[model samples]
Target: MTGTGAALTYTTIAGRHRHEIEVRRSRFIAVLERVESQEQADALLAALRREFHDARHHCSAILIGANREVQRANDDGEPSGTAGAPMLEALTRRETADGRTDLSDVAAVVVRYFGGILLGAGGLVRAYSGSVSQALDTAQYVQRERCGVFQVSAPHATAGRLENDLRGAGLTVRGTTYQPSQVLITVAVADSSAELEVFRERLAGMTAGAADAAHVGCEWVDRV
Candidate 1:
């Protein structure tokens, strides 16, 4: 799916993270993990269930797909819309530092230990949402984007300088290949017509119109 203003990108969790909160003597543990498919999400829930076997309730929410089109929530043993629904809302409404709310390919499971006291529906919603939100606040994030690959061929003597200049200009230098007579410097740019044109212009300026870059392919990459 496309992102803001022709740029295709979304925010997602970097890895697995766990956090716990206590409300009215009950313990809520939130586990957040990156999952690319429904099968992976299911595996995550199964593993958590095995890990916290004695928990009173194990509510879960999963969002899978680049556009976050796959959404699933289970209230488990709690009242309808009290646990899983709020947790899913927390995942959907999370914003990045740059104010983007498109978080995808992730799963959240909230395990609750009853602690003898019964909480009302409203209280349960707040506890579930708060647990996931707090865990998200402490998690590391990365951007998943579709990027274009380009190969810039340069002379062996000046290839190093060209690579350094490309990096200095905030381009991702994927790798360098040594050829018989020249070197191929692989670079990645956002996969948009505007961005590709800009890259061509920047390369021309960097090489003084002496070198050209050929578009190779497009790929999705995670950027920190």
Candidate 2:
């Protein structure tokens, strides 16, 4: 119910989303997968290459990083800029909730099965771009959030009641674990100083100083 730490979120493919289309006798199969780093993207490309080895061409484009900062595209023997460029544009220009059109952390691969046809440069561009666009229709996105995680400990008898009370207070309790002498409660909130302060005070009052919170760490987590 407070500041979100000026943290930002980006849009990306939910998981592995696929779509296929035939154009001018050429079959284009597009597969989209979410990836967090260059290594992951490379692995996907390698896997797809082996999976669609029989196809005429296996083109791909990868965009990763919070800023969608990294980009790589390969035409894979197609006309220069015909296959990979258009596909890159299709995925790179996606708009986020805050109006940033730079989509991040998505790997898209297009496999072409030639049907004894020669689609010119223009046609190839359309086919590749269209492949990714169609797959995006059914794609789901997991929003990455910058969250603050903290821990608190309480006596075993009061831990359950404390968790319930924390949840009732509109807190996002990440998890709770039991120990021999006490219980450990972990909670997360928007990454912000204000939110952390609020959490500390709320826990103090709820347990009458019996519960004290400790800052764990911060990272991006998926949210539906």
Per lDDT, the best of the predicted structures is 1
Candidate 1 lDDT at 69 equals 83
Tell me each candidate's TM-score: 0.83, 0.86
lDDT of 1 by residue, 23-114 (tens): 99999999999999889989999999999999989999998777788999999989999999999999999998588888988999999999
> How would you encode candidate 2's per-residue C-alpha lDDT over 33-52 as one tens digit per residue?
99998899889888988988
Model 2 CA deviation exceeding 4 Å by range: 1-7, 98-102
- Runs in model 1 deviating more than 4 A are 1-7, 155-157, 179-182
Q: How many clashes (backbone N, Cα, C below 3 Å) per candidate?
A: 0, 1
Q: Give the lDDT of residue 221 in candidate 1.
A: 82
Model 1, residue 167: C-alpha shift (Å): 1.1
